[model samples]
Target: MAILLAPMEGLLDFVLRDILTRVGGVDRCVSEFIRVSNTLLPDQVFIRVVPELLNGGRTFAGVPVAAQLLGSDPVCLAENAARLAALGPHGIDLNFGCPAKTVNRHGGGAALLDEPELLLAIVAAVRRAVPKTMPVSAKMRLGVHDDSRALECALALEGGGASELVVHARTRADAYRPPAYWERIADIRAVVNIPVVANGEIWNVQDALRCREESGCDSLMLGRGMVTNPGLALAIRAAMAGPDASPAPWGNVRPDSSLTTSPALYPIINWQVLLPFIAEFWRLVCARLDRRKQAGRLKQWLNFLRHHHPEAERAYMALRTLSEPAAIGQWLALQ
Candidate 1:
C-alpha cells in the first residue's frame, strides 16, 4: 500500500510538509494548489507554492513532491503546467477536489465536477503539456452537489490520460463533513483502468484499513488526518505489517475514554518525540512567512495536533492569544 500526503490549501504548506515529511512514512506529497487564471503564471508563482521545486522536487527528507494546479481553463492550465514542468516537480496533479468557495466561485475545483467534458479537457491538456515521462494525476470529489456523476467524472479523467486518480469520496455539498463514501470509491476503481487512490476520513490505523478494504484501493491519501497525527502513515504500515511489531515509545495508544476521542484507535507520537519537529516547523514558518502570520501558523497547527496529543492542547492554550514571536518561541522551548 502507498501513502501520499494530501494537498491542503492553507494548512499544509511547505513548512508543514517539510516538517511532516521529516517525521517519515509518507511516500509522496501533493503541494497546495496554485490557481491559474487568465494569464500564464510565472515560475516564481509555482515555486512559491511548491518550494520543493527548488530542492529537486523532493522534500528535505527526500520524499517526492507533486505540484498541483487548479484552474478552469484548459489552455491556460496547460501553458502554466508546461512552464512548471521545466522546474522539475515529481509530477503534476490537477485539483478538481478543493471545496473552497473562493476557488469554486471562479469555476475551478469541485465546480469542474459538474462538467465532465471540461475535466477531461483539462487533464488531457495538462498530460500533453508536459513530458510524457512526467505523471499527470487528477484529484476529484464525488461531485459538486451530488455524486450522480462521480463515475462519469472518474472515467473522464482516465479518458484524458491521467496516470492516477484520487477520489475524495464525498461531494462538494458535504463540505468536510463526516462519513466519507468509501464504497463509492470502489465503484470508481471498478471502471477506471488507471490506479485509483482513496482519500477522505482516514484518521487512524483502523480507518485506513477500512478505507482500503471498502475502496478496493492500494493507495490512500492522508490529509487533515496526517496533520493531526504526523505518525499516521507509519502507524498504518506497522498495523498492516505486524500489528504488534511497532517499537516502544511509538504506537502508544491509550484506551478510548470517549466516543469522540477514540485515542485507542491510533498511535500517539509523544510530545517529547514531536517537539523537535515542531521547533523546526516554527523556524521555517518564521523564515518563510511574514512576521504577523508566523504565530497564527503555529497555533493553527496546534489546533489540529491537540486532537491527538494532550500536550498540544496545553501548548495551544499557552500560545492562543500570543502574537509576539519571542513569547511564542519561549513557550515552545519550555514544552
Candidate 2:
C-alpha cells in the first residue's frame, strides 16, 4: 500500500516536506504546483520550488519528490517537463486539480477538466518529451463544474500515456469543501487503466479506512489531513498493517463513528514526539523563507495543528498576534 503526500500549493512546500517526511509514514511526496505561463521558465524556477532537486530529488528523510507543473499550453508544459526531468525528480506530476480562481481564470488547473481532448494532448506531449523510464503522472479533480466528464478526463490522461493518476475526489465547484466524492474515483478507476491514487477529505485514520474501502484504491494521498495531524500517514500505515494487539495508542480504536470493522490499530504521534520536528521547521523557516513571511508560516501550521492537539491550540493562541520572527523564536524557545 503506497501512501503518497498530496501537493498542497501554498501550505506544503519543500520546507514542510522535509519535516513531515522525517516524521515518517509517507512513501513519497509531490512538490507544490509550479505555475507555468507563456514563457519557458528557468531551471532555478523548478529548483526554487522543489529544493530537494539540489539534494538528488529527495527529501532529507530520503523520500522521493516529484515536481508538479500546472499549465494549459501542452507544448510549453512538455518543454518545461523535459527541463524538470533533467533535474531527476522521482517523477513529474501534472496538476488539473487546483480549484483556485487565479489558476482557473487563466485556463489552467481545473479549468482544463472541461476539455478532455486538451488533457489528452497535454499528457501525451509530456509523455513523449520525457524519457521512457521516468514516471509521468497526473492529478485531477472530478470536473470543473460537475462530475459529468470525470471518466472522459481520466481516459484522456491514461491514453496520453500517464503512468498513474491522482484523483482529488471533488469538482472545481466543490472547492475545498468536505464530503469528497471518493466513490466517484471508483467510477473513474473503472474506466481508466492507470493506477488511481485517492485524495481529499482524509483527516484521520477512520477517514482513510473508509476512503480506501469505498474508493477501492490501495494507494492514498494525504493533504490537509496530514497538515492537521502530522502523524496521520503513520497512523494510516499502522492501521493498514493491522494491530499488534497491545491496545496501546492515541485516538485509541476509537476511530470516527463510521468505522467499526477495524480496531484502533494504529498508534498516534503524540505531542511530545512532534516537538523536535516543530523546532526544526521553525529553524528552516527562519533560515530559508522571507523574514516577512516567517511568522505567518509558523502560525499557518500551528493553526492546523490546533485542530489535532490542544497544546497547539495554546501555541496558536500565544503566537496569533506575533508577526516578528525574533518574537516567534523566543516563544518557541520557551515552549
Q: Give the Cα lDDT of each candidate.
A: 0.88, 0.88
* Model 1 weakest 10-residue run by lDDT: 255-264
Off by over 4 Å in 2: 245-266
Tell me model 2's lDDT, rounded to 2 decimals: 0.88
Stretches off by above 4 angstroms in model 1 are 243-268
Give the C-alpha miss distance for residue 115 in model 1, angstroms: 0.7
- Number of clashing pairs, model 2? 1
TM-score of each: 0.93, 0.93
lDDT of 2 at 95: 95
What are the per-residue Cα lDDT tens digits for candidate 2 across 137-251? 9999999889999999999999999999999999999999888999999998898877999999999989999999989999999999999998898788667766564433333
TM-score of 2: 0.93
